[model samples]
Structures are given as C-alpha cells and as structure tokens.
Target: MSKTILYARVSTTDQTIDHQKDQAEAAGFVIDEVVADHGVSGISTELKEREEGKRLYDKLRHGDTLVVRWVDRLGRNYQDVTDTIRHFMRQGVVIKTVINGLTFDGSTKDPMQEAVRDALIAFMAASAQAQAEATKEAQRAGIEAARRDGSKYRGKKPSYDREALGVVVDMLGQDKGASEISKATGLTRQTVLRIRSDPAAADVTLSRWES
Candidate 1:
C-alpha cells in the first residue's frame, strides 16, 4: 500500500505544526511520515534545502502521495511552487492538499484531463502566489499609512529603551547614516531615519524602534 507522507514547516518557533497536521488528518490522509522544518521562512527558502523537507523528496516514490496544508506550504513563489509540484507529478507522485481536497497525478492518459488539471494547478498556484504578495503589499501600505498620520496608528505601545534612543541620537549627532546607525544600534534603517526626521515625536514614543 502506498503511504501518505505529510510535510509541514513553520517559519518560526512560535508557529505550531499541530494545526497543519490536524488539517491533513482531517482530510482523511493517514500520514506515514511527518517532515517538518522550523524557523525557516517560506518566502526565500527552497523546500529541497530543508533538512526534514529534503527527506520527503528523496523518500517519496511513484506510488506515494504527499500532503500539505496548502500550495504555499510547498514553496514560496509562483514558479517555484508550480515547478516543484509538476516535477513530482511527472514522477508519478500524487499531490493532495487539505484546503481544497485537490489532487494532481500524472497517471492519467487523457490529454484533455491532463490539460485541464495542469491549467487548474497553474491557476491555483498563481493565485496563491498573488495572494501572498498582496498580503505583503497590504502590510507595507498599512505601515506607510500609519507613518503619515501617527495618531491613526494602532500598533503596540512604544517601549524603546532609553539606551537605544540615546544611541540613535548619538549616531545622528555624529552624522552617521541611517544604515550605519542600524548596524551599530541594532535598529532598522527605517527606524534610524524616522528618529532623525522627527526628533520630537521620536523622543516622545520611539515608535519606530519598538518592534
């Protein structure tokens, strides 16, 4: 019998793998192995590079099936995610996801079915990639909007320590660039520049350095 392999990854220690596993199990997959990589960002890291994730690639075979929570779980970008799934399909590996109960297999001989399946996969993968980018853009826009009118900002209360603000001011006083101040004080360049640009508000809250 072909065994179902579960691949789960969390970008940080704070993220739990149980949620993903539960989703897979609820989808009726009897997981034979659970491969997980912790604290690895899906945005830039390739699935093949992950320690546990790499084993899934090597161990999965023609009769085996791979399950993930979503397509985004498989890869970070549109091309990368689509390429990885297509490669597996060509190898006779069945891909399934909990989100949509979608399945992709290369065993079908029907050209029409193949074309339809491939097109759907591409569309869904592209949609997933676009959603990820949209989320990032939304986050950036929110930050920018917050910066324009600090009163409307609803972020956490500023808690920048006195020492860090002192370093930032000293860096500015010395004519050190934002990048240099970021490196020296462990504050982001954006934070350094924000402080330099608005000393009054920066001194009051130091909001830029809080996060």
Candidate 2:
C-alpha cells in the first residue's frame, strides 16, 4: 500500500511538528505518517544527516508520497535539495509540497514534462538556498551592528524572535496575509505588519535581543 508521509524540520520553539502536520492536512494531504527533526538547523544539517530524515530514506517505499511544507525541508542548499529530489524521484517516489501544491513525479514519460519538472525543481531549490543565505547575511549584519553599538543598539525588543521572524518572512514571501501569518506564528497582526513593512529592521531587532 502506498502511503503519504510528511517531513518537517522544527528548529525552534516557535515552529511545531503538529502545526506542520495540520498544514499538510489542511492542504488536503492524507498523511499516513509524520517525520520531523527537532532542534536541527536546516541551513547547517543536510537532510540525510538528520536522525528522522535518515529514517525517511528507509521508510518511504517506491510508490509512497513524500510531502513537505516547502522544498526547503528536503535539504540545506540548492545542490542538496535538487540532488535529494532527484534521488527520490529515481526511486519512483512522488514528491509534493503543501504550500504551492506542487508535484514532482518521476513516472512521467513525456520528455517535455520531464524538462519542465526538472526546471521547476532547479528554480525552487535555488530559491530555497537564496532565502537561507539572505537570512544568514541579515543575522550576521545585525549581530555586527549590535556588537559595535552595545546598549545603544538594544532598542525596544521585538515581540517575535529570530525563528518567528523567519516564519513571518517566509509567509510573506508566500503572499500570506498579515492576519493569517499572525495567527499561524502566534504573533500579533501589528507585529506581522511591522515585519512585512520593514523586515531588515525586524531582523536587527531579533539580533539585538540575541546579543
């Protein structure tokens, strides 16, 4: 029997495995199992390195469906993400995303469809890596500014933390409404709006608090 499994990486307290599962279910995926890695940095750890992530390789069968909140959940970088997707597809596993309802099937025999699927995978993987890099850069810059300025850099603390900010940024990128992001992240709509209005400032706020 082919089953659908949802994989999630919960790196912080703000993000929950249940929330991910719920998101997948809401997106109409009849998930048979859920695999998640807690306290794992998606940017630092490759998917195969994660404890539960490794389980995915063993648990998923040829016809099983692999579901994720986004393509970024599969790996840490562009190369890693693309490689992982291709590897799974080669094994006859179908990959799907809850966010965009995107599907990648290796069973497709059409040459044009294969080309389009490969292109889309490449684009999404690159985008995931780009977003990760941008977040890292913003944090580095914020930390440097905080260190140089000391107490002066510490303004009123942001209601949301680094992880929350990242979630907000991601939802914003997905074109989610401020109210929806606020409800999802447990942040106020005003905070979501503020982050939406000035993400760099939000990043600096989070970094200042971290320092």
| Root-mean-square deviation of every model | 6.7, 14.1
TM-score of each: 0.69, 0.72
TM-score of 1: 0.69
> Model 1, which residues run further than 4 Å from truth?
12-15, 150-211
lDDT of 2: 0.90
lDDT of 2 by residue, 2-51 (tens): 99999998877888999999999998999899999998887778888889
For candidate 2, the TM-score is 0.72
Instruction: Give residue 79's error in model 2 in angstroms.
Output: 0.9
The deviation in Å at residue 31 for candidate 2 is 1.0
Model 1 lDDT tens row, 46-155: 78877877887898888899998888888667787888898898888999989889998889999999999999889877887788788889989989988798676746
Off by over 4 Å in 2: 152-211
Worst 10 residues of 2 by lDDT: 149-158
Q: Quick one: best lDDT, which candidate?
A: 2
Clashes of each: 0, 0
